[model samples]
Target: MNKTKNIAVLGGDARYLEMVKNMSKSDDIHIELVGFDQLNQGFTGAKQIDLDDLELSKLDAVILPIPGTDGLGYIETVFSDKNLQVTKEWFKKLSKHCLVFSGIANDYLINSVNEAGLSLIPLMERNDVAIYNSIPTVEGTIMIAIQNTDFTIHSSNVIVLGLGRVGMSVASKFAGLGADVHVGSRSKEDIARATEMGVTAFHMNELSAYTSQCNILINTVPALVVTNDVIKTMQSNALIIDLASKPGGTDFDYAEKRGIKALHSLGLPGIVAPKTAGEILGTVVEQIMYEQDLGEE
Candidate 1:
């Protein structure tokens, strides 16, 4: 029995290409590639076509890039020259049963999908996906720290904000590299975990108190945790790596005014390890599709 399902893969970076390749290997998937005409190679079971050519009514699922869309709903099509907009009308065209899968979506995508009565799946929200993603994110953060700092990570005062998945990984890696790692978080359990891991732990309230001696300040929190007050307390030569999403945790304008080198790095997995990231997403998507099929049964 050929239990193939139709999927429309819309604009994205190189990761999408790897994902398509992975999914196409399975005899159960039939892929339609949109906004990817610029790519040289072709997939075995995939058809490259324009957005207009995609029959939303026939699609079992619509796969979008990790970033989903720009704030204005423009899908990120790095491989194509076309400006592909994911409007509400596009969602309206999709079959009511069709699943829309993407990474963290913007408010526009969420509202539009809701209005269109389509199911939107935010893949990054899954614990398996986020934890897997933290690997490449932390690696990229360490890469940035190594490239930007004059001194080695060894014995340096490193403060990692947020005790989330990415933060935990960042703090662990720095500590492994012989850095004096200090984890800042609000949760007492998280702080205790940091201490159990043999690293210093402090509440976020004490962030400013400890910032003055920080050589490498890595922020995984997606809030304005690194404000002007925190920046002012840091050494002028300290390096700040903000791994949160756009408009990151750090106040970039204030950091610059104070002559601090603060970098807001978004989409690290796509940048540093696209193939691995793609494989992770592809695995998760495959699982979701199988689950959906079972639900229908």
Candidate 2:
């Protein structure tokens, strides 16, 4: 008889609730839920248990939420009252063949996983996952733009920084909304792609020249590309929506002092569409496990 694979899901947001549900569908996968005591929903075959109660040596796979862990090694759990720390010592207990998955990686997580000699996969690094995630992110971006701006997206001059997966989608969606979209990027190929998409493309070096006319500025770049100089050039009433990870690209303090509206919106997938995001994650996780030949006799 084939042995059931043991999967441990660590702390996470509402999206993880759906992830637990999706993973529970497979009879061969036995899932353990951690840091979810506050959740009232129940998973059919999953067991809710504390981190200390988990038999770490029996874990076949471990799932950490997006954002992974903080620099101090504490995982994010909106539903938990206690801090869940997955330290290097904790990782050492995992089975040698155990797979670890997270939405993104941090230095602390990378170091810990490396010390334990474990395989760590950051799903957000996958092209398919990133492309799929862009859907909800763009939707949330549009929603925020509409709510924050006084004028319609139609005919508004929108500047999008970066041409990554999310940036490309954001630019295309704004253009589709009839906004005069301008994409700023450091890559010549990305600029060419933006032009082909029927949007104005310009080098990021010339960002200041365009900022004065921008009604809405969206940043996908993780770096501090949207500096005080860039913000100073923008209109007083302009809206800055930064879609990068935490501590976004824009100069928020400067923007606030300048009376410009700036927002750092993170985890839009979980916030705007938890079910869809969770399903996307579930599909990728299952595919990965299959490729690894896991859960088979």
Candidate 3:
């Protein structure tokens, strides 16, 4: 006889709801959901309950929404009107052996989880998850580019900064759309790969030289790669889409001053395709739980 794994899912958006629905289909898993009453749909094997009713000690794993916690520790829940806080005190209630999983963790979350001596897994850091996530991100980026730009993608000169998973996807998609794509990277290997993909590749140092000709500039690096000098070189009508996290990699103030349209598009997976994004996350979580069960055996 095997014991069912008990998991607590905390505040999240529509993707989380979809994830809960998918995960609840498994009879081996019992799900406890918090901050999701406003949603009309319900999971088959999941119970939506107040946070106070949750038994932290009984949880085998704690699943947080992709955004994890805001810097202030408040969890983002779109379905619930009430605010939900996953503070250090809440963490303290969890069993020390419980595993905590989320997309990205903030400084406060990292410190708190470390202090509590619990294992924390950042799903976004996983290569498999990040690579799969790039698909939706690239689709969303293309949608944004089309909506914001006056010209078609057919002949636009697009510059993609960073040759990471997301960057590569963006470059390939634009090129497939008949755009003249240029990829910028710090790595020689990445540059070579980009060139092999039939796109022009340049070292990061040459960003300013290429920015002037760019009709669309997409940044995947989470650093200050697109500085004031780089922004200064861009055309006035150029669209700057910073796909990086909060604060992004672009000089927003300078781009605004130059009359360029700059957008910081974060969490594209959840925004553009919630069902697919949720399945991606739910599949990973299910795999993790299966491995954990095998290990226990």
Q: Give the clashing pairs for model 3.
A: none
RMSD of each: 1.7, 2.1, 1.7
Write candidate 2's Cα lDDT for 1-297 as tens digits: 145779999998888888889989888889999999898889887989999999999988999988899998899888889889998999999988889999899899999999999999999899999999999999999999999989999999999999999999999999999999999999999999999999999999999999999999999999999999999998999999999987889889999999999999998998999999999998888788877774543
Please give the CA lDDT of all the candidate structures: 0.91, 0.92, 0.90
lDDT of 3 by residue, 1-297 (tens): 056889999888878877888988988889998888887887889989988889999988999887899887898887888788888988888998788999898898998899888989999999989999999999999999999999999999999999999999999999999999999999999999999999999999989999888999999999999999999988899999999987799989988999999999999999999998899988998888777778878
Per residue, candidate 1 scores C-alpha lDDT tens digits across 136-255 of: 999999899999989999999999999888998999999999999999999999999999999999999999999999999999898899999999989999999999877889999999
Worst 10 residues of 3 by lDDT: 1-10
Spell out the clash pairs found in candidate 2: none
Minimal lDDT window, size 10, model 1: 1-10
TM-score per model over all chains: 0.95, 0.93, 0.94
lDDT for 161 (candidate 2): 98
